[model samples]
Target: MAGVESAFPTKRLSVPTADPQPSFLVFGAPRIEEAEIAEVEACLRSGWLGTGPRVAQFEQDFARWRGVTPSRVAAVNSCTAALHVSMVAANLEPESEVITTPLTFCATVNAILHAGLTPVLADVDPHTQNIDPAAIEAAITPRTRAILPVHFAGRPCDMDRIMAIANKHGLVVVEDCAHAIESEFRGRPVGTFGDFGCFSFYVTKNVVTGEGGMILGRHEESIARARILALHGMSKDAWHRFSDQGYRHYQVVECGFKYNMMDLQAAIGIHQLARVEANWQRRRQLWERYDQDLAGLPLQLPPPPEPDTRHGYHLYTVMIDETRCGIGRDGFLEAMNTARIGTGVHYLSVPEHPYYQQRFGWRPDQWPHAVRLGRQTVSLPLSPAMSHADLARVIEAVHGLIPA
Candidate 1:
């Protein structure tokens, strides 16, 4: 199908003595409201602003949103922290290995190392940019204890296949669900699929508590342990000690990290959580518009996935077809910027980074497909706030950038 040329308003947006290139069009800015402000003020004025009612309520809201019970979720300060908690929950040995993709954010690999497990690299599917289930199975060794799969760019990974593999090998599954808060796979929410799901609420994510995360688990004991792990191993969170229990008796069973979410961050979530569906719809609309408009472009767009799998559109990434466009990925990024659009690369391969290379001596040949994509995939602006004009601006920018 031929893609539409542009979705810009017929009337050009008035620009008064503009500087270079549309004032650096942003990617995923938050859409906060007065309700958020009021919540923060209430939290402040209430005299108990730590991990109080707001954080507790946010955890409940998050659980309800994902169609899971409260025992399934525990709030934390960052997804990285949540991942660390998941690793601890798995009880992986110091030399045990966790297989994951090379094309994800470094945090995914870093969490493995932080948990005292070896981070094993695996190749990704050329199309999905997700860790191939076959490759994950092949990477398993006697020391392999867990399989960590990233739901890349809010698109659901192939969970059924991955779960089957993990089940067969008796390996724990830890999901890196940073970009996929509202995503579903085969009618089931992504966070509810695995033994542990770690979600990020960083500034760029679908949901924004500014910087926070939630670790979801099925068992009560696991979630409780995660809560303890997140709260410095304290038996009493502020919620239970003061607000709920009205008592000070606390216990500390295990050593843990200080990773609890603050009341201030929870304030933003109380408001944003209500609008999650609306925001997701907005992103879906923008994705469709981009898909319709960029149909025949030289780039290789993400193809439709199987039925019942909803894309959160956390990132509308595309790969540069050097063979077709005559321009490689880096050159394409430069060209796009020149045409007045904002773009970003989701990652350079985790192995390609200096720290990993120097420490592990990881060569590009370790994960060839990931190496190829590390040089190709560029994330286009895909935010709920992005309007039709914004989509048009992106389309116009890409058209001008690509060499005909």
Candidate 2:
């Protein structure tokens, strides 16, 4: 459970010598402003509220922004739905296995279960909190049908290694990109790497629409299948049906569910997407300040991307090894809370969930790396809403709590 060291520790951080203090704090607030609200109101007034022009435009815009064709993107109501649709498109057989990280949100694994795939817990590399790519080959077996890799906390996984293993094993790749909106890996955006990339626009995400998601597929057919799975399995073009040239005939070609994105949400999303770039810049500056300010602090700062990638700053997390910090993560959080500062845990290892434990019978020691992460990690507030004073207060609190 060793943590990675940062390069500029001398100038970036200092070990705390006193108790900390923070008057206020925030985490991942929506970057949208009044214009976003106006967009939604326009949609409301338009009266075509359900999966209509606005939703279609959102899907089209999202695809264009991602540099993918429109047919390769399917807008849905939740990342969970996007994942569910992706898993179905994967055509996984019942009881087939999918290897995924334990240090992700439950939705990632639950999507596998909902698709009737057996979820296999893979321990993370403590350094990255990403599924250890090396362990994946060992986890693969005849029953393995897919590998779902989550870009944890907006940090892209080593896609090259993961993809290589998937190709060798003939397993499908479904990336859980719920935390990563514009995250990149090796100079390419994250959602573009895998067979299917599922994104969440939950209130807390980098590009959110209150509640919605998008699935980016690698192939037109695969993307089309996802659309079918999302919209009650209607195979015909849902759009052309109502036009004069459109035919009345349609077919329920597949067994599917309704996971369509509503016009209202899409309206909100159009504006959120525009502000993401600017919000990301401020996020980078704030993140750098946190690292620099806490450089010599007792615990290690989270490592930056390895020169070839960009983190979306979804969560400004730092790892605390009690042995180094002289306090465990829980105690440190308590101290921060007492100082009127707020904090959050991104997740514990996914396998620790009751359903997984009962079904997989996995143990904490089995994924030692993920277990260690759950024990030692804490999420510092990082959002565009935070002011300079708020940032300073967080630094002050952390510096105060570290034992000299």
Candidate 3:
């Protein structure tokens, strides 16, 4: 597979080398094309780098891709902003608890705090690495206002069970879809199952917009309010206020944050969104190859995608337990870096971080599975931009690291 040409056009950053030291492979490198470059250049030339037509176009494109109406989505600066705004728009009571998985990015928890709500941790399933529905049910209290379920690593959480739990408890559902743009569960997209679905377009994400996100809402009014809240709570956005027709007066409906997505970022995202399917296919190939090559290594590979579910294949993670692999997780990271290959730790469970511990009196022991998985998890490179030679280099480096 090393020398085989890929079905998609190669976006190689470097050629295979005999040099003991070569260019360090950056994890999560985005696959950028000439179309994106041209669109960005055009956007710069238009003198409308702020939130404008490009942002509007990107939002429409994304909404269509997600099988929703244009009015159902609102673009923002980051997934963090999306989460924060969604929670605010949902009208969750201040300081009311929002249940979420421990095995997710801090932004998920922090958004609840930003929205003036308490974030309660629910332990994840050891096998699925997603928030267990039972844990969510067990964590719910009279004050629990919402459920924030992250589609961790692009695997859709058991949405049917989760929705059932949310429905039973009458809790609002705000899906953290930062890793699940292309994920679907049981023939339906992941984000649609919740009241509000938040997605990311960070530089390393499946869609590269430098820094951008979008919110999908079940109700038009909620999405419209989110749009207003995203841009300083103004009744009229900049695009409408200063369009070619004429300047229009606007009113500030409520105090809000500056979370609007810029046209410059949207320019890159428009083309990226167009190529999403092709890129997803490329990533699927790489994921399958990784499974094949990494087999028999003393590591715990991610389980197969679940039935009736479409995984986003965002990260190819493996748990390197020292007792079996003869190398600690941190040591494996160091070895990979020494070999000029890059890797990532998807996360260190929320409670493991000191800020959460000090603020909430939480401990890793409370969520043992998340803590253990966090300690051993390593995200190997998985990007459409990677060449077969690059794949071979990573595999060779990993094979060389483990003891016989």
Candidate 1 lDDT, 1-404, residue by residue in tens:
34454554567787688555465667787777798889889888988778888898999998888888988899999999999998898777887999999999999999888888899988999888889999998999999999999999888999999999989999989999999988899999887778899999998889899999999996778888899999889988887887655688888888999999999899888888899999999988888888888887888887776588988789888888788877888998887777666788987889889999999899988899998888888999888877788888888888776744
Residue-level lDDT of model 3, residues 253-363, one tens digit each, is 999899999999999999999999999999999999999988979889999999999999999999999999999999999999988898999889999999999998997
Instruction: Give a tens-digit lDDT track for model 2, residues 1-404.
Output: 33545433657566777755434455555667898889888888877677878888898889888998999999999999999999999778898999998898888888888898888877888888888998888888889989999998889999999999988888899999998988999989998888999999998888889999999999898988899889889875445465456576779999899898898899999888878888889888999999888887777678887778988778888888888888888998888887777788878777667877887787878988888788788999887877898889889888887853
Superposition TM-score, candidate 2 onto the true structure: 0.89
- lDDT scores in order: 0.87, 0.86, 0.94
**In model 3, which regions exceed 4 Å deviation?**
1-20
Candidate 2 Cα errors over 4 Å, as ranges: 1-24, 236-250
Clashing pairs in 1: none
